[model samples]
Each structure stands twice: as C-alpha cells, then as structure tokens.
Target chain A: MDEPEFIAALRSLPLHPGARNLEDDCALITIGNETLVINHEMMAEGTHFRPDADMADVAWKLVASNISDLAAKGAEPVGVLLGHSLGRDDARFLQGLKEALLAFNVPLLGGDTVTATGASTFAMTAIGRATHHPVPARRGAKLGDAVYVTGTIGRAMLGFEGAAHHRAAFDRPEPRLAEGLALAPLVSAIMDVSDGLLLDCWRMAKLNNQTFAIDPDAVPVADNARRDECMRWGDDYELLFTAAPGAAIPVAASRIGKVVAAGFAPLVLGKNAFPTADNLGYSHG
Target chain B: MDEPEFIAALRSLPLHPGARNLEDDCALITIGNETLVINHEMMAEGTHFRPDADMADVAWKLVASNISDLAAKGAEPVGVLLGHSLGRDDARFLQGLKEALLAFNVPLLGGDTVTATGASTFAMTAIGRATHHPVPARRGAKLGDAVYVTGTIGRAMLGFEGAAHHRAAFDRPEPRLAEGLALAPLVSAIMDVSDGLLLDCWRMAKLNNQTFAIDPDAVPVADNARRDECMRWGDDYELLFTAAPGAAIPVAASRIGKVVAAGFAPLVLGKNAFPTADNLGYSHG
Candidate 1:
C-alpha cells in the first residue's frame, strides 16, 4: 500500500477527537479551555534530504518543517519531542538541533534515539497552543475572498533549479509564525505553501468547494523566465491565505488571486482553467 | 558525541519547563487542571529489532513500547501520532498497527510518512492524561520505601536468549495498565522496567539520592537457573515502583528491596555493593 492508502485505512479505524480526518496539517484537541495543536513530520535520508547534506542543516529543516504546520494554524509552540535515528556523525546534528531550538525559543521536551543500518530517519512532533479559537483551516475560503501569499514562491524553485542549490529556500525556509499569528484573526482561511503555491491553492479551493481565479501575471515569482515552473514548485514554506477583497493585510504579501464560484476546475489562469496534470502543486506519490 | 554527551548538550540549551533534563520517562506538562504526558520513541532495524522479525510485530512492539512508558506514569493513553517510514511490506505492518491500536483503545491522530531506502526506522509519540495528581516519578523513592516489581522479570531476557523463544513474553508483554492505575495513588515513585530490574533499580536509586538493598533470593526470576543473568537482562516491560511501607497495596507485586540512605553505591545485592560493569542496564553506546 502507498502512503495515502495507509492514511485512508487509519481514518476508517478509531481515531481520537483531535484527528481532523487526517487531512489538516495539525491535530486539534481541547484539553481544558485551551486547544492544543499537534503535528508529526518525518524526514528520511535519500528522500527528504540529500545523502551528502550536512546533518546539522538536515536537523534544522526537520524542526522547521514541523513548526511550519503549527504556524499555518496560528499556534504558538509549547515544546517538541524528537525521534532521532543516529547517523554517521551525531555531533553536527546535535549542533543543528541546539541551534534550531535556540533560534525558535522552543524546548526539547523528550525523545528516544536508536541507531540505523542503511538510511536514517528523524521525526519531530511539535505541540502548540492555539492563539485563536476556531483555528483557520484550508476549507474556510469563501467566494470572492482575495488570495494572498506571504513571500515570493519561485525562490525555492530557483534554489532547486541550481541557483545556489536552494540554500535560502530548501535548506532553511523560515516558518511564518508571526505572520500566521497576525493573520489568524483576520483571514478567512490560512495554510502554508510547502507543496507549492499553485498546488496548495488548488487544494484549498477544492476542499472549500470554491474556484480560485489566479492571474499568472499577478502571482509573484522569483524569476519570470520560469513562472509556471515556479508556481508549481514547492518547499517555499510561505503562508497562503484569503481575506476580504481590499482588506488591509497585516503582513507583507502579494495578492495573487480571488476565490470565485466553483467551476470546471478548482484553479485557473486568468479565467482559463489549468489542466489538472500541470496546474497542481508538488505531491509525494 | 555519544548519547550521554548529546543529552547533556540539550540540557545546556533553553529548554521548556516540562523537558525535565530529559531524565524522566515522559515530558510532564499541565494544561489548566489536567496533566498531559508526552513521549517520543524511535525504533530502528538491526539495533532495535532483528532483521528477520515480522513487520506486523515490529509495528505492535513500537506502539507497545511507547504506551508502556505512559503506563509507568499511571496515565491512560489519550491518543498517538505515528511517524512511519515505508518498510518491506506495508500491509503486514498496517495489520499489526490496527491490532495494537484496538488492543490499547487509543486514537490515531495525524502524522507524516516518508519513503526510505535500506533499513527502515519508525517512531511513535504517545499522549496521555494523568489519572493521578502529582504523577509518579523515578526520583520519588524515599528512605525505607519498599521497592516492588510487577509481573515476572527476565522473561524477555530468556526470550532474547533464544531459550524456549518466549513468544508471548517478548512479542506481546502486557503493559500492566490496570495495575498501574490502581497503584498510582499509593506509590512513592514508579517507572517501567524496560531494562533489567537491577540496572533500573540502580537508576531510580541514583536519581533519588538513595540506596537500594535488594535480596536476590526475594527477586522473582523467570528461570531460577539463570537468576543472575535475568537480573542483568532487559526488554521486560513491567512496572517497578517504590511505595510507603505497609500502605494499603492495591496491586500484586513482589517486594524485592527497601530504599536506604545514600551509600557508596546506588544499589547492592544483600550486603555487598554490585559492580557497575555488569549491573548497569543495556545502554546505547
């Protein structure tokens, strides 16, 4: 079975009240008056990170990726539990871990470690408390809502396309925590652009039963040479959200599209529906 | 750096209050009136389980080991987030995962999955709610407290030794959840005996600043012929705790020793102090 099939099987079984159908980026459960946000992300050798990548950078990326999920929901991190499989050298990983924890001001609560044979896998589960009740979800986008992206999408795409080896985008994509927190109370829907803006926008529109009329000329790209590639490329780790048209956005972002009535497709380029085969963002098979 | 050195480095960083110096079994965080217990454990191929082991059993053991930690703290599992790396056969692993989830009656929350090459590693983070306030800890044993152990020791050890191939003992050792809930209010300190009883006892004593004077004759062994070996072996997921002398004991456990004042050694056999070279538990180097 594949990953999506495995998740579908789990959904059929008994899941907790916080599971969210395994669709959202984070699980939400109310312990008392506060709602706790939790997420688990796994990074594997050879697949998620380059085999020759530095262990420290890999460690940083692992933590950053999980935290980004919380940021999408506008939750403040409480702590994290790290499940680490030791690699060839652990000192560099430790250095990177310490740096990430310090940089984020998050604590390493507890975790277990084991040695691996072939490839190493690291897992991080970040626990956060919701800053806003009814945390924003991808399905809340409404008709006529304006779509916005926090940062340039094509930087990571360019980085992946041999421009400095994606050092700025893939190696250390920042979680828009502050922007997420600031936008949580104001936006109709919010999500992180990890798997590419165009794909993620399609996801939000499909899940919300709305059509996103995006103008390729309006969508911010790092380079105009490959606008389509940059729009479909992922790993940018920016915030993609929707607000009322002309609403004052608290964060610096580009107004890329508008939420329209459901049409033949969830996404379009200036009223022309984009093909599913090419319009969607990056997805792991 | 080694495991101990790696942990020590984490201690130097800015950690959350719940981190507990990475010494306790789980991270304890009280949200409002409830205490939520969290833990993350990673199991690897070759190091944690035999390469020839069944994928279903590997999945079962992964969940069981994590829930066992919650049992030690006298907490009931709330839910779990699984960080899975695709293995040799996913169907078998899913079957085991389903059986284990049903057996424990815990919910499956959201998590991430990734593909891996070579040997695979899987991790699980268990979230539990404390049934008893002032939840038990490894450092709560007091002088003159009676040390008790649940179930039988060295069963997993003998199974690991390939003697009789203790299938039930090693494959599905009970977590003693019921006994833990019954004894949580009465116990002074408690923890799961994943390692050998002797090594774990020494750890509890050293952490609590007390000494344990254990009688080998009183310690229960799976096989009397290998009593010494059993005391040094681990993988026995049983509850080992200390309680007030003569307090209404609610669980069936054999009293193996008594807590004493600080001495030259943390643990002793009868009147002689045990050597650390062999008495310590199985530690990752």
Candidate 2:
C-alpha cells in the first residue's frame, strides 16, 4: 500500500473523540481522564524459534515475548492480533496455537494469514492500558536510583546452550507482570531484558542519560554454569528496573546495582563494563 | 518467553478507558463517541519474503502488505510497529528499512529486534483506524450484491514466472488504498485479492454465507498468460469488493459477477469450474 493511500484512508475514518496519537504505535485514547496505551511485538519462524521446536511451546513463547514488552511499561494486557505464516497451517499447529491463546487469556481479535515459501513465522501484536502514572519508559531512570531485577537471569541463555532445563527457561521467561504492575507506580524507569543483561542495561542507561553500576556479585544468577556467561548470553526476558534508594517497592527484586551520573559506559564493580570477562549478554548491531 | 510469564506481565498494565475488547487482535478503543480500531499483521522471511530479496523492495512490500490489509477493511493507516530479525545488520540493510518506513510515512514506533537462528524475517504490525461507518468486512456481502475489483489482476502471479515487469508487479503491488478508503464508507464488504480470484472470492462467499459466481471471461487479467493459471495464482493484493448494484461507489471497478443464495461451491463460468486445474493460487494447510 502506498503510504499516502494508507494515511489518506486512515484520515477518512471518523476521528474517535478521545483518540490521541491516532497515527502512532502507542496511542493515548482517553476515556474521561484515563488513557489506554497500546503496543505490539512479533516473532518469526527460524528467526524467533527453531523450525523443529515444539509447536505448543512456540505458541506459548510468542505470546510471552510480546506480553513481556507490555510488562516493561506496566501496561495491562487487553488483547492480541495474530498473523500466522501459511507454512505452519496444520491441524496440530492450530491446536497448539489455540492452547497458547487460551492460556494467555488474551482473546484473538483478527489477523491475516499467508503461505510461506519456506520456514513458517508468526507475529503477535499486544494491546494494553497504560496506568495513571507516566507509563514506564526507557528514559525514566535517574542518577542515584538503585537498579534491580525481578528474577534470576541467564537461564534462558543457558537453555539455548543445550542445557534442557535452561533452554526451557530461555524459551519461556515469564513476564514480570506482577512486579511490573507493582513497580509501575514506583519505578523511575523500566525495560525488559530481551537481549542480554549488560546490553539492555547499557541501552537503558543511554536512553536515560545515566550510567549503571553493577557490583557483579550482587547481580542475580538464575542457576549456575557461570554468572558472567549468563549475563552476557542473550534471551533472558526479565525486568531490569530502577527506583529511589529507599523506595520500599514490593516485588521480588535483587539489587544488582545503582544508576549514577559518572562515566558514560555501564560499569561493573567500579570498572568499565564489557560483555567479556564478566557479563555474557548478546549484542545487536 | 513462557506464555504465562508473558501474559502475566501484559495483564498487569492498566486498562484503556474506552477499550471494549482490548485483548483481541482487533480492538475498539472508544474515545468518547468515536471508536478507533487497531490490528497488527506480521510477515516473516521464508514466509513472507525471501531472505535475499531486494532489501528496498522487500521492506516496501512488507509495509505495503500490512497496509493492504487495512485498506481492504476501509480503515486508514495510523502507525506501524516493526519486529526485525537481526540476521545481517549491515548499514545497507538499515538503510533499506529506513527507506521503507519513510516511503510509508509511518513513524517507527518502538519494536523488538532479535537475531534469527536461520533466515532473516520482519514482522510489522499496522494500527489502523476505522471510519465513522463500519469499515467493509468479509462477512458483510448480501445475497444480491455485485462483486468487483480495483485495478488489473494476475500481474503479480505472472511476475513470479520470470516476467521482469510482471515479477516486479508481483513483488510490489499497487495496494488499492485510495479506492479502499473511498469505498469503505460505501461498500458492504471488502478484501484484498492476495491469494487469487477464485480462492479469495470463495473465501468472501464463505464468510458471507453466500455463493459468489464469476464469469471467468469477465474477470480482469493482467497479462496474456494462461487464463486458468491467472485465476489461481496468488499475491495479486488488489481490492476485491462487493456492493449493491448501482451503489454510486467512488472507485472505478470492473464488474465480475454477483452474490447469490449459497451454492454448492464457489462457481466459475469458464470451460469448467473445476477445470482439473491447479486453480492458479497458493494454498494453506
């Protein structure tokens, strides 16, 4: 579709009286004084999952991955849109899809389906309501705020390394919805750890113009093969959050470090941070 | 991401004030009297596009494909979210992505990027707003409504046959955004002809509980290819709409046939409806 054609068609629709940011991904549609915020995430075949992976797990993982993004912003789940590649259109696949959707309780609204030339892919867009307070953004962290995480990290990455239990952990890192919702009203800034702990922390710090200082020892470890490897290896979908030193938050959190206004780069134990030697998180170009 | 963990996080976000059904693929976010509808469609590599396809055209078609879906609904484009696979994050690739976004004039709302295990894929979620009147739906055709199409058909399929121009046409379709936007308020039912004339029309008929009869000769052809093959080949992506006779629609359309009380199967008026043929389109299991 031509961009103009799309815009023109959208403009032709009657403006919803309270819809704000109509042409943006996150819209603040107001009802009275409250705003509902929305965003979506998609996973593809051979890209997000292995073609030979378990179908039921694939469906479950797609939903989980997208919902994790919502959790980062403390947004409540409303529903989802699913686009399925025609490659995986068998009855067994459908059964798994149904199981995943039902398990999430996020009803399927509507979506398009097409045949794929090779490996199958699936996309899921998640919608949710924003809380009254500022929706937690990647830019909300402040100097002097302490950094914390909801659960142990590196398990998901470990799972990817052929450790069956760890692979399952990596495959299905639970969204910290409880922690996110609880912390939404308290945290300075928030984001989910999808890439690697060090990488995500670096990104969050850059977004907020702050530096993260991890004690290395304080960083929570999921299980043990190696703490540094876990931190650097990607796929740990946990919540990396920041709050005031004495915020008295009520989520299961382990203080990994603190946010500070010092050197530009993330630091570990008062030293410049690097994925090697300590953190083992993955990097994206 | 585990389904429960992901869903738990999503469920934690605050609810939108006007969302009637926020947890579905398509949701109604009411802003006062007006309600904005949102949906997302994701396409993948080896599924939607070849990994080594022209990056620029691939990106353009990705956006266009999702936008085409919105066009079919008579909904206007609002924004888009992209889930990109990090197979090869080269400068040229990023440039291609930027061009596609700029071409669509849709802002890059936040999206997730992850490295794929195999071929590259991209998932795009298009959020569109429905106009005051109900946007056309596949299930709205009546027993007597006439079926019509916008623009020439079958060029895309022909493109796949190594016809350079036809191939380009196949890869990049002129999404009938203008016609769809213009007809949304007027048409009873609307959809893009992504699959083919025979199959898509069949789908439309099935959705509306009516039988669609098409005079094969009356159907527009894009080239002098085999008549039967043209009817079954997929990837045309044109608007196949249905409306009452003489509805005074704004878009120029070619009349093909009419809707009738349910028929035993989708009917074709050529040599034989069945033709012992491949039907010219791709199929999903």
DockQ computed for model 2 against the true two-chain complex using alpha carbons: 0.17
Poorly placed runs, candidate 1 (over 4 Å) = A160-166, A271-279, B159-165, B275-279
TM-score of chain B of each: 0.95, 0.82
**Model 2 chain B weakest 10-residue run by lDDT:** B16-25
> What is the C-alpha lDDT profile of model 1 across A165-255, one tens digit per residue?
5566776778888998999888998888888888888888887888888888988888888898888888888999999997899999999
Looking at model 1, residue A88 earns an lDDT score of 52
**Each model's DockQ?**
0.70, 0.17
Q: How many clashes (backbone N, Cα, C below 3 Å) per candidate?
A: 2, 42
Q: Candidate 2, which segments miss by more than 4 Å at Cα?
A: A1-52, A85-100, A112-121, A154-168, A222-226, A270-280, B1-52, B86-104, B157-168, B224-229, B270-280
Best by DockQ: 1
lDDT of 2 by residue, A163-242 (tens): 88776676555677667788888888888887788777776776566678887788888656487777776667788889
Quality of candidate 1's docking, in CAPRI categories?
medium
TM-score of model 2 vs. true structure: 0.79
